[model samples]
Target: MSSPLAFDPARMFAVFGMRAVDSAGFDREVVQAPGDDLRCVFLWGKDCYNCNVFKQTAMLHKDALLDLGLTWFECNVYDDVALGQRFSLHGVPAFMMFRHGKRLGRISGWPGLPQFTEAVRRLRSGPAAPPAPASTQ
Candidate 1:
């Protein structure tokens, strides 16, 4: 068992694999308008019933995904409203997939690992280009 406060990036990659993006550093504004090629994980705080379940599942999957170098962002809904609406989230534990700043797909509720894995694979297989680097040339 891991400490509650401990954040293990490697664990996340193992579960989500290469189809996830770690958005832990993302600001509220950035998530609202994420650039191309970024997939976000919206983490609703413990206030919501669904959020609590999602967090637990996420914790278990985090270690697996982390080991595989997968990417994922954890966004606390309490911290951002604009982002929530941008994804049109009507409930907690929502997983929104985006590409080139456009929504590609989403799955809401406490989906089991198999379902979650499939959703991620489908999104990863979608046609989404990487964001262009800022011009410093």
Candidate 2:
């Protein structure tokens, strides 16, 4: 059988990884936007099976989203402790979708590719009117 695809955290991090968001910026960008067409953030703590699954799913969707003019941000739990605490991320492989800085949706654990795609679609479509205010508010 063909060898399993290698898991290169460095490469993945480079491609999908997020930059350091200072406390103020993280609060404004991730915790304070207020619309449907917001940004997408993926938080990963460890290189576990679930995180791997999500990574693959993201890879599949990355190109499509790029074509659609969508934005995605990746946060390494080890690197972003302050952001992690802000989100109360006690688990790895967590997915959070935001619009205008407000959290539109969140999915944790390994839901596989299908579920991940669905979550993205839903978030992209925006919350069903009357969305909650930004996190900072």
Candidate 3:
């Protein structure tokens, strides 16, 4: 495997492996799923124990995610701090969802694959409800 800092989208499938691509590649596969596909970006950092654990969980639940027709990508935050910052990611081992170049939702932290799947399901279900309207003068 290449250095953790390198972005390689192809290696994202391997255990704890994520594409160490540059910002452009990150835009292509991650920011934009390209052809309207539901995509999931696994945001992690080096030396992050929780990030490692989350990856293991993703490896185990790969099938489940596939069943949901979700495309996966691995993004090392340290490799692209800008991207992480843009997504408002303040922690490692975060999951960001996107479709047709638009962000759907995100779930941060290691809440287990089941919970992650559930959250993704929610994201897939439909748009989140808007806040109640404020009273008019």
Candidate 4:
């Protein structure tokens, strides 16, 4: 894959109307440490077929995001290497949820709309952090 920094945010926003960020933008303000709105970051690869499909799916459901007062963005892992590294991206077409600058949840690959919405609902309702690791007795 190409360097993640290579993706053009201008072009991304122009084409998708969804905020697309490079490493610089990613670090600047795309995520809020103590943010008020729920942020959904979609990580994709330019050459990934699944990413293309997910893009369409996301667009179709964008109103749902807006109604939920969610902020959605797309990042090309190929162009934003640092962001991908930060998220430890395992594959393309992954969706991650964030709020208050904290990651709430992530669901990899498209699991269909019903399942996807359920995941989003869970993310919106769940605590910012997962429960602490259990102690081994």
Question: Each model's TM-score?
Answer: 0.58, 0.64, 0.70, 0.70
- For model 1, residues 4-123, the per-residue Cα lDDT tens digits are 987544444344542322344344433455555445565464467677666566676666544423235555565676656666777777766555656566778778777877777777
Task: Write one digit per residue (lDDT tens) for candidate 4, span 1-137.
Answer: 76876543334344445677677777555664455677777788887888867656656665664566667688889877888888888888888877766677788988877898777787767775545789999
RMSD of each: 7.5, 6.0, 7.2, 8.2
Among all windows of 10 consecutive residues in model 4, the one with the lowest summed lDDT is: 7-16
C-alpha lDDT of candidate 1 relative to the true structure = 0.58
> Residue 100 CA error for candidate 4 (Å)?
0.9
Cand. 2 Cα-lDDT: 0.63
Poorly placed runs, candidate 2 (over 4 Å): 1-5, 13-24, 31-36, 60-69, 127-137
Mind sharing the TM-score for model 4?
0.70
- Steric clash pairs (candidate 3): 6-20, 7-19, 7-20, 7-21, 8-19, 8-20, 8-21, 9-19
Ranking by lDDT: 4, 3, 2, 1
Candidates' C-alpha lDDT: 0.58, 0.63, 0.70, 0.71
Stretches of candidate 1 exceeding 4 Å from the true structure = 1-38, 67-70, 128-137
Candidate 4 structure lDDT = 0.71
Worst 10 residues of 1 by lDDT: 18-27
